[model samples]
Target chain A: MSTDLPEWLLARQEPFQHGDGIAGGKSIRRGFVEKSVDSMSLVFRESFFAERLASRPGLLQGIDPRVKVLTTILLIIVAGLARHPTTLLALNLWILWVAKVSRVPLPMYLKRVWLAAPLFTGIIVFPSIFNVVYPGDPLLILINFSRHFRLGPWTVPETLAVTYQGVWGALVLILRVGASVSLAVLLALTTRWQVLLKALNMVFVPQVFIVMLEMSCRYIYLFLQTTSEMFVARRSRTVSRTSTQEQRCFVSGSIGALWNKAYILSGEIHAAMVSRGYTGTPKTLVSFQISRLDWLWSLFVLAVSLFFLGGDRIVAW
Target chain B: MHIPDGYLSPQTCAVMGAVMLPVWAAAAKKVNNVQKTKYAPLMAIGAAFTFVIMMFNIPVPDGTTAHAVGGGLLAIVLGPWAACISITIALAVQALLFGDGGILAFGANTFNMALLLPFSAYYTYRLIAGNSEAASSRRWLGGLAGGYIGVNLAALAAAVEFGLQPVLFHAADGAALYCPYPLSMAVPAMALAHLSIAGPVEGVITALAIRYLQERNAGILSVEASSSPLEGHSYKKLMRGLGMLILLSPLGLLAKGTAWGEWAAGEIEAKMGFIPGGMSSLAERWQAPLPDYGLPGFEHNLLQSSTVYIVSAIIGLGIIFAITYIFSLVQKKTTPDKT
Candidate 1:
C-alpha cells in the first residue's frame, strides 16, 4: 500500500466530530465507557478506603458489624420520624461526633454526606418555597407573572414569592437526608464489605440473595475491567472521526456483548460449582460474635435516639 | 428514580413497604419453584449484571447522557419472578454497600422498580408475543412494549408517592413535610421525564438486545418458548399451515368424482364394485350437528355454498382451538403444582 494519502482525502473537511480523541473540541467529552469505568473505580476505591478505616482502632470499628448495621438503621429511622429541626440537628452533631471518634476525617465525612445531600434534596425542596406551592408568609418575592393566570391546570399566582415555612421545611428535609446519609456513610466507612454482607445475611436477608450479592460484588469488577479494555482499545484504534450514531450503535452492541458474556459466564460458573459438589443452596462457615461492647454500643445509640425523640415530642406539645 | 431517604414519610414508607411484602413473597415462591437452588449461581450473575448495567451512561441527542434501569430486559430474559429477585438483590447491594438508595426505602424501591417493572413487562410481553417464534418480530415488539410500559409504570408509581407526600403528612404548624410537590405537579413532571426519555431508551435497548440475542443465541430465549404447547411449530407456522390448507382447497374442484370412502351407499356400490356391510350400516347410524359441513338453506347457489364453506371452516377452526384449550386445562389439572 502507498504511504501517501490522496490530496482530495486530505483536503476534504468532514462534518467535524468532537470529544472522541480525534475530533477538535474545547474539552474531551467522557463517553459512556469512561463514565462507567469511573463509576466502577469509585466503588472499588470506596470499598478499599472503607476497609482501611474499618480496620483502624476506632470507636465504631471495635463494635460488631451486625450491631453497627442495626444501630445505623435505627438512627436513620429516627431521623426520618423526627418532626423538629432540633432533633435533626442533634442527629447531625452525633453523626459528626461518632465520625470524629471513629478516626474518620470530619471534613471528608462531612463532604461525602453533606455535599451530595444538599445538591440532591435542595433542588427537590427549593421549589416548595414558592407561594403557590405551600402558600405561607413570603420571605423573598421572586417573579410576578403579571395577573394570576392558569398555566394549564395549575394557577400561577400573580406574585410568586418564597415563604418562611417553605424555607424551614426545606431546611428540615436537607437535615433529614444529611443525618440519614451520615449514619449510612458512617456504617460503610467503619465496616468491611465482607463483614457487612455477613451482617446483612444474619439480619434475615434471604440466603439466595446473599449469595447473589456476594457473587455480583465479585463480578462487577470483572465486567468493569472488560469495559475499560473495550473503550481503551477503541480509543487506541480511532484514526478518523466516527459519527454519534455509530458510537450509539457501539454502545448498544457493547451492552448486548456484555450481557452475552454475563449469561454465558453464569452457566459456566454454575457448572464448575456443580462439579465441585455445589448445590443451589450455599452454606458459609463464617460466624459473628457480639461482645459486651457491641451490646453497649447498641444501647447507647438507642438511648440517644429515644431521648431526642421524646424531647422533640415534648417540645412540639 | 431511586427515592432516597427523607423523601417519603415514615407512615407512607411503611404502607408501601407493607404492600411489597406479599409481592416479594409471591415472587420468591415463584422463582424457587421455577428455578431450583441450582439456579443460584446464574441469579447471582444476573444480579451483578443488573447492578453494572444501570451504571452505563448512554449519550443521548442533546449532548447529554441517560442510564437505563435494565429491569425490563432482565424480565424478558429471566422471567418476571427471577428478574424481580435479581433486581431486589441488586437494589439491596446498592443500598447497603453504596448508599445509592435509602435502606428504609428499600421496600418502596423494590415495589416500584422490582415488582411493578418486571411483572408488568413480563405480562405485556407475554400478551404481545403469544406463542410466536423466538426470532419473530412480534417478540421484539413485545420486548419494546414491555420495557416502555415497565419504566413508565414504575415512574408513575414513584410520582404518585411523591405527589401523596403533602396530602398525607403535614406539621401542626401548617408546614408541608416530606415531598412538597402535590400529585398534580409530581405526576406531570415524572410523566414527561419517563415518557419522553426513559421510556424510549428502555424500549429501544430492550428491543435491540432481544433482536441481537435472536440473531446470536436463540437457544436462551427458551423460557417462554419451551412452555408453548403448539408442538414444535410456532403460532406463525400454524397460521401459515392453515392458510396453505385454505389455498389448496381449490384443488378439490379439480377432482372428477367423490372422495374415496366419502361416497354415498349407491355411489359406493357403483364405484367400489361392492359395499362392505359394516360401513354401509354404520354410516347412517352416526348423526351429526352441521352435517356435511353445510348450513341448511345456504347451499342453493355458488355464492351461498362458498359462504357456507367459509363459515364452516371458521367453525371448525374454533372447535380445534377449544379442544386444544380444554386439553391444556386437563393437562394443567393432572400435573402437580410445584408448590
Candidate 2:
C-alpha cells in the first residue's frame, strides 16, 4: 500500500521537525502537516473566497478608520501595559473572542499571529538564555540549564542555568506579542485599507500620505503583474535553466526593469491624474460616521481592557 | 523606530507634538507659497514615489533594514518646507494604510524623518555643492553625505524617541523611565550600520534617479531651481566650493569626538558611583517593579548606558534643528534668502 503511493504523497508523508520538541510524534504528522494543509486548502476554497468577497457588514466594518484607528491605538496600549501573565492571557482570549465575533477565519488568525513567534524567540528566548546563565537571580537558575562558570574577581558570579523567572519572562513576552499581533491582524482584516486611509485623513493624517498610499497600492499590483509576465517570458527564453543563481538574476533583472517601468508609469499616472483634476490630494467616496454602535463597541472593548489592566495592577500591588 | 503607544510617557509625546506642530504649519505655509497649478501634479507624483520606494526595504547587517524615505532628495528637488509637508503626508499615510509605523508616534516620526533630515541634508548639500557648476562626482558626493547624515539623523531620532520613554514617564516604581540603552553605544552602532546600509542605498538611488531625470527631463530640475538657488549651477563653481567641504569634515569628526567624550564621561560617573541615578533608585524604592527601560536584566551595563546617550544626542540634535527651522520660519520675513 505504501509502495503504491505516489512520489508526492510519499514526500507529503515525511516527518516534520519542530524547533521546540513540544509536539508529540503523532501530533506532528497529524496536526502540523495534515491539518495545516487542510486549513490552507480551506482558505483558498471558492466558498472562502466568496465569503471574503461579500462586503463586510459588521458594526466594526462601517466605523470610520479614524475611530478604528483610535480603537487600535487603545488596544495596543492596553495590551502592552498588561504586565501580568493572567491579564495578558485574558487580553489574548478577549482578542480571540473578538476575532471570532468579527468572523475572522481561524487559519488566517493563526497564520498572522504566528509571525509573533519569531519575534518572541529572538527577543525573549535568546535574551533569557543570557539572563538565566547569569547568577544574580536564583529564579534564573531554576529553569533553563545546569552549567555555571565564575568570571574574574571583580565580576558578579555567573551561572549557566535557566530559571523559572527566565521561562516566565519568555512566556510573558510571547503572550504580549501574540496579543498585539492578534489585535493588529484583527484590525487589518476587519477594516478596508481605503476606508482606513480616508478615516486617517479626517483625523488630520496629511493629504500627501493618503495620495501616496493610494498611488503606491494601485501601482504595486500593476508592477507585480508586469514583473510576473516578464518572469514567464524570461523563463521561456532560457535553455537548460535550473540554477538558483540564474533564476535569482532573472528575477532581479525583472525587478530592475520593473523599477524603470514604475518610474515611467508614475509620469503617465500623474498626467492622467492631472487630466482628471487631481489636485495633490486623494479623493475618497467613503464617509465615516461615528455611529452609536461604534461608540458602544469602543466602550465595551475599553471596559474589558481596563478590567485586565486594573486586575494586573491590583495583583502587583 | 515606531515607538508604540504607551511605550512613551504622555508628557513626552505631548512635548514632541508641541514641537512638531509649528514645523508642520510652516511646511504647510511653504507648500501654500509654492502652490503653482503646474507643480501640483509633480508634487503628488513625487509623494506617491516616496511611499512606493519606502516599501522596498534595503537589507542592513544589524538585523534591521531600512529604505529611503527620500526626505532629503525631495527637499533638494522641492525645497525644505515643501519636502517636509510631502514627507509628513507620506509618513501619515504609511501609518494608517500600511501599518508601517504607529499612529501615535506620527509626530516624532515626521519631525525626525521629514522636517529634520531634509532640512539638515539641504544645508549640508548647500555647504558641499555651493553656488557652482554641478559636477556628477560632486553631486554624487553631496548626495552621499546628505544621505549618510540624513539616515543617521533619523536613526538618532528613533533612539531618542525610545530613550525619552524612560525619562518622561514614571515607572511603576515611581522612578523616571528612560531608554535603558545609552546613546553612545546605540547611536554609533546604528549610525555606523546605516552609514553602510541605507546611506549607500539612498545615495545610489538618489544620484542615479536625479541624473536620469536631469538627462531625460531637465525641466524637473529647472522647476526646483526657482525654490533652490543651488540647483542648475556650474560644476566648476561647486568644485570651488570644496573649502566648506574640507572644513565641515573635520567639524563632523570633532562633533563625533565630543559626543563620544560626553558618553565616556557619563560612563565614568556611573562607574564611580554604584547606583546609576534615576532608574536604579526607583528600582530600589519599588521592589520588583518593571525596570524603566523594559529590558529585565543587564540594567547597569556600560553598553546600555552608552546606547542611551548616543541615541539621545542624535534625537536632541535633530530636535534642535527642527526647533531652529520652526523659529527660522517665524523670522522668515527677515531671512527671505535662507530657504
Q: Pick the candidate with the highest DockQ.
A: 1
Candidate 2's residue-wise lDDT over B186-205, tens digit each?
Answer: 46656776677776666655
Instruction: Report how closely model 2 matches the true complex, as a DockQ value.
Output: 0.07
Give the i-RMS of model 1 in Å: 20.9
Q: Chain B, TM-score, each prediction? A: 0.66, 0.60
Query: Residue B114's C-alpha lDDT in candidate 2?
Result: 81
Q: What RMSD value applies to candidate 2?
A: 16.5
Candidate 1 residue B246 Cα shift, in angstroms, is 49
- What are the per-residue Cα lDDT tens digits for candidate 1 across B1-339? 898898887666666666666556655655665556547776778888888888877767776778899999888888877788889888988888788888888878998999889889988998998888988998889989999999999999899888877776667666776887889889999999999999988888888778878888777777535432223334355446545644653243233354366688789888778988998778778765655555777768878776775565455444434433443344335434332
True contacts kept of 1: 0.54
Ten-residue region with minimum lDDT total, candidate 2 chain A: A28-37
Worst 10-residue lDDT window for candidate 2 chain B reads: B250-259
Give the per-residue lDDT digits (tens) of candidate 2, residues A164-198.
54454445556665666566656666676555556
